[model samples]
Target: MMKNIQLKAMGKINLGLDVVRRRPDGYHEVRMVMQTVSLYDKVGITVEDQPGIRITANLSFLPLNENNIVYKAAKLLMDEFSIDQGVSISLEKHIPVAGGMAGGSTDGAAVLYGMNRLFSLGMGQKRLMELGLKLGADVPYCIMRGTALAEGIGEVLTPMPPMPDCWILIARPPFGVSTRFVYENLHLEKIDRHPDIDGIVRAIEDSDLEAMCARLENVLETVTIRKHPQIEEIKNFMRERGAVNALMSGSGPTVFGIFENERECRSAAEAVRERGMARQVYAVKPFNP
Candidate 1:
């Protein structure tokens, strides 16, 4: 009998993101505080007799073949572990694709973690994290999960104390924002300001939501909001409707608002949805792990 395992691939929100510089490798150097959210894609994995990979997802936008991160993760593991068995991966996506929530990366992380457990691969978390870095910069943080301070092209992670459980309202517009475009357009010298990630880290440690809100900032916000005015409008609306804090997540067309409880989050989500300005609106909580 083949082993089967199920795992939840959680999404992430960047509390603060600052692009420090562009690296020689064509990737932007960044300092960001990333927090996992309760919004997730559920992935199911079952070992197959043949040595190949397969993926299925309800979202037509997600690539189901080698282009899929889940498939890439499975292939990487098979090569590293010298496994002959193939895997069947199925994703039930709750997170929007290319919405700056690191959904695909999270799915890949879940696959790597679940496969290790199901197949008794004996690869430790550290080893898995190392492998994940080869897949994407965000993959390491996804593997770690919870709250983290990410730096240096987003591959370096320092795990932080979890943020207090709160409701999250995410609003994504109809169009996608290219992370590359945002980075390329950034005038590093002309960019007059940046966020204090260390300060945000301190506030999170102290569990001070108010202080955190005061410090919630993303340098990328300027670039993204310029391109998509709806992001700014959404943030303004969420604030007026009782959000404790509102900001864009990652290089976003998706903006998020924080609330003290589910009631507030639901109310904000409904308000945003009723406006019919965004592609999607979600009422979710921060992921504990």
Candidate 2:
């Protein structure tokens, strides 16, 4: 039996996100086209005879105990299966933390995925995704990876065609935006425009990059941009440098630009760093797995 597992926890981007409504349970209803990107965090897990969960990470600020979603994931699985084996997880983070990308959620998904395999649990993707929902709204999509349409507080997922091949320039400023803060400040009645999520879905199915880029929008941007103008500045910077389109991914803070040309994408990444617009920038491609 395999007691050790190593996996790449892929990051994700919101091609188009629309806040449909707020649920009675206080969760927001959303319609979004989500795509996995090449950006990822490295996660390693080991099972021992002792019974406990230990987590360590490259980021010191990251909680190593129950406060972390990853730890919660480990506990969830162990409890569900009545496994008494000790588990240790080590994370090397490359994805920007709290940048609207599914960084932490993906890491948690990775733990669920790895543990399922390591212990030879019979849970399939569908079953794993259901358990993932208990960890976080985005965890299910992270486990589903590739391209998907996410709805119903992000637990409902429909696998979509892989996004058209293109360079994705991901840039995050020195600051991080709290997803909770953005949602708390959002007033749905005040939203002037909601993204055309159906239009984006059609574009992806047809592999029409131009149409997809044209429809790229995130309703959360209205709330996020107002508080941090740098989000807009980064988008403008990318657009001025020949990007097809630039938009904030999920809630705020991280802005990704789509480019057909690799040279232009790399050039933009360099310029963003040189201008001090964002210290963390990556020129990656769509990751469909």
Candidate 3:
């Protein structure tokens, strides 16, 4: 078995997110197209002499115990496989926590994937995805990594085509958004429009950047933007600054713009930084690998 392995926990952005309806289980039935982006967290997994999982993170505020998804993933793998071997995991956080970036979910997926290789567990992708589902709804998609249409509380995934060629400019304000609160406050009557998923899919198939941008929408934005006007302000700023399309991702305070070129994307990121519109800014591309 390899003594140590490092994995990238990629982040995601929702091109379109719509709540279909409220389910009986208290979870909303959702239809959203989620895409992996270049922003990521680096996680290191190492074999240890002890007989349990130990987790440490560079971020001071993050819990290294069971509260962390990485710890939970390691524990789940050990228990499921009946392995006695101990493991130590360290997280170098790059993606913003609780910023609608799927940071925690991807970290959990990375652990499961890295451990499968580190311990030589011989678990295949299907089994890994199955196990990932137990950790979080987004974990399965993170393990798969790419463009996907996620439905049924974000667990049901159907692989979609690669996104159009463009740069993704992301900006997250210095504020936290509670996914639970956003979901709880979402009233279907208040939503005037839901995203056109089929239209976006057609645009993707045609590689039409403008059409894809035109169809960009998220129902969650109605609730999130109402609570934080800055989210909308950032969108307008990006749209005016050479971004063909802009929208908030997931239950966000993080708004991303789809820029046609690298120069414009970089300029927009720097401008957002200089204008104090965002706490964190990134100019990145879709993560195909």
Q: Where is model 2 more than 4 Å wrong at Cα?
A: none
Clashing pairs in 3: none
Q: Tens-digit lDDT track for model 1 on 1-289? A: 4389889899999999988888888888899999998888999999988989989899887789999999999999999889898899999998878889998899999999999987898888899999999899999899999999999989889989988667889888889999888887888898887898888999999998888888889998788888888888889999998999899998887889989988888987888889896878889888865
C-alpha TM-scores of all predictions? 0.97, 0.98, 0.98
What tens-digit string does per-residue lDDT give for candidate 2 at 22-65?
98888999999999999999999999889999998999999999
Clashes of each: 0, 0, 0
CA deviation > 4 Å runs, candidate 3: none
What would the TM-score be for candidate 3 when compared with the true structure? 0.98
Query: Candidates' lDDT values, in order?
Result: 0.89, 0.94, 0.92
Better of 2 and 3 by lDDT: 2
Q: What tens-digit string does per-residue lDDT give for candidate 3 at 143-187?
A: 998988899989899898899989999999999899999999999
How does model 2 fare in lDDT?
Answer: 0.94
Candidate 1's C-alpha runs over 4 A off are none
